[model samples]
Target: DVRECLARAGLLLEGAPVLYLSGYKGGQVNPAKGDFVFNCSAIYELMPTDVRLCQPAIFSGKVLSALGSIIAGIGRPMTDAMGTCGKAGQSVPSSGGGNMFLVIDENDEITIGGV
Candidate 1:
């Protein structure tokens, strides 16, 4: 179902990725509050295909649900995709996480541009 969704959206890749980058984040955090290190991130994942094919507003929302189903089917805890937080020109220690190694073809919902 996920593959079908991506293919319909014209995002199914036919070759290996040209690049995959991450491990860096920069976003504003409040010192008065928890100063969460989220809402922003720097990730560049490029595949060997036409980048212009991404459908910004395709109908049907089955892609995300399908991906979630895959994660649930794994029956294993996911690792946290952690990062840093900064506020008042000072970096603060924080804690949070996300699942990794999810297998759902090209699920865009899980790849939103945010930390």
Candidate 2:
């Protein structure tokens, strides 16, 4: 998730002639302990077959899953932190940094810009 967001903001693929960001964060956790921190990257190139669309639904499930795992790790505190336990589980306390970008290729020219 961090890497994907970074790639979108043009922070992760500066030297590459072409780069794609894809997929979601995958990691392990222990309820007795805590969640796992990961360093990752995901890319999806803008191809004729795909419009390079970044849909919210594309990562929604994964986000929910990860959030669920985070909530589960906290156990009883989650019930209080979230106040509910549904399919998506509860929210956890978190903070992070990221960027958003819009990359455009015009006539073989590539322009990397922030979103």
Candidate 3:
């Protein structure tokens, strides 16, 4: 699991801090162009017990598809239904999915889909 990997890598500290578990209902991606946009929602967990809401933000970056491949190399891959997706001139059922864990040292830098 990615969590275990993070722990082994010395990324998961004793406090555990805040962890964001995110899911997106719909999105668009262009593999050739290395671009993506998602309508995402997330759960914010503060260590042992406290749970809080997080604001959604746009995720834009280069090589998103490549990012997925990199994540799979280190952790487990997973897919689940978020809802529906539409792109170009076609509408179809689509889901947003990814690996189990990614550890970021800076909390302020974290961005999720929807609050």
Which candidate should be chosen as best, given TM-score against the real structure? 3
Worst 10 residues of 3 by lDDT: 106-115
Clashing pairs in 2: 20-43, 21-42, 21-43, 21-44, 22-42, 22-43
* Candidate 3 lDDT tens digits, 56-95: 5554444443354332223566676476556587767667
The better candidate by lDDT, 2 or 3, is: 3
What is the model-wide C-alpha lDDT for candidate 1? 0.38
Q: What are the lDDT figures for the candidates, one per model? A: 0.38, 0.33, 0.53
What is the Cα-based lDDT of residue 69 in candidate 3? 35
| Candidate 3: Cα lDDT at 51 | 50
Off by over 4 Å in 3: 1-9, 14-19, 43-52, 64-98, 102-115
- TM-score of each model, in listed order: 0.26, 0.21, 0.45
Q: List the candidate numbers ranked by TM-score, top first.
A: 3, 1, 2
- TM value for model 3: 0.45
Best by lDDT: 3
Tens-digit lDDT string for candidate 1 (1-115)? 3344344545546774322223444444333542223232233344544332222221122433543545222224554645555557766566654443233444543344321
